[model samples]
Target: MATWPNAAIATLMETCGEAVSNAAWNAILNIVFPCPTYLVAPEQRLDSSRPDLTVYIVGENGVFFPFEGKPAKFSWEKLGGEVLGYCIAARPDAFQGYNYGMGGNGPECIICEYDGANMRYLYIHEGELCQSDKMHVLHIFRDAAEILNVLEFVRGAHV
Candidate 1:
């Protein structure tokens, strides 16, 4: 049976009538992650760069998730660099989580890259930008159900 992520992707393709674009992905994310307390903004500027989507968890010390979406043909290395730059420039605190001799709290940010057919989740910890071993590739066609569960878990929601 098709899972939630696959179902969502199918619905998006039907709605878009073409390969899903960054804007379409942002809209789909809003639907999947609906909330009155969280804000999902598309095409938001981060320093001199613009991320495809920026999700802000509302409240004191709100968190931000920077997402980059591209066509399936795009190169992930190039896209990852761009997203990394945005994260570094707009949310440097995310990279300081494991800094030496630091005691103050640093923001934890998850950098997401989606290329229509696949999704990759990355993070900056201990001065290294690394992909989660558990969630390196979330293939829309092959791993849709797991993708939905992983996303919820990443967002700290019970699955």
Candidate 2:
């Protein structure tokens, strides 16, 4: 993960709606990668649903992670439920989401997935877990390890 400027964080914190949040989140994610390794597609439409963003590994077919996005304030329950639904619909091992900020505390991430036949969801602020189905949260963008893990998941899914 790149070290983002405080100004970027401030803009995200002030984002007022789903659209702005998604756009900002998309821009940040693109900046996270140098392109051609993994690609972040905003508002990509799938057959069953349209995810707010879809992360894809280049040159790999059918290997993608669908994601939802919400502004600073939103229904966590709603985000969790929708991501889980995406998991079921897309039938991937996992799904993800981004909340521009969580109650103005900072950005949060939501991950919903099947863990050995049991489904779980996590709401994370930075690297901290708030509402969780597991002992830890999926802090997708918190650090390099976390970002690599997501890439591994995407690659492993199609293998």
Candidate 3:
């Protein structure tokens, strides 16, 4: 896959243009990810529950990432469990088999939590939902360059 880290972020920022709602973020992602390379589906059902956004690889049945967006004021602790549940329900095989430091063989799925300005990356490790301190929290405005890395990782291209 081609890597255009800055390009994706730039498109997202341009599309949203400071808008912070879940719908706005979803729209930005849809514009950023088009079709063939990725399919961005909103309010997709993962088992009996639905996540705010579900990204899938082109022609693939499994999910690449499950995303949940909220306002900037929402508490991470309260929303963390819900995002984790969606990841588990959406891709049980990847979540259950994920192991820390296993390179490309590690978990391929991610649960993305973003609030207008900030974004959080969550993954399943050793039967528990965890976030690395380094990438636990990312700011959209300040960390524009790094956003591409997050997108690539979630797309299973950086694993």
- Which structure among the candidates has the greatest TM-score? 2
Q: Mind sharing the TM-score for model 2?
A: 0.60
Model 2 residue runs over 4 Å out of place are: 1-8, 11-15, 31-33, 91-106, 121-159
Better of 1 and 3 by lDDT: 3
Worst 10 residues of 1 by lDDT: 99-108
RMSD (Cα, Å) for all candidates, in order, is: 10.4, 6.4, 9.7
- What is the descending lDDT order? 2, 3, 1
Residue range 7-31, candidate 3, lDDT tens digits: 4453454344223345444543555
Candidate 2 weakest ten by summed lDDT: 97-106
Candidate 2 lDDT, tens digit per residue, 65-154? Answer: 567777665666777666655555553423333211111112555444544344554343466433346533333235335543443443
What TM-score against the true fold does each predicted structure earn? 0.57, 0.60, 0.58
Which 10 residues in a row give candidate 3 its minimum summed lDDT?
Answer: 99-108
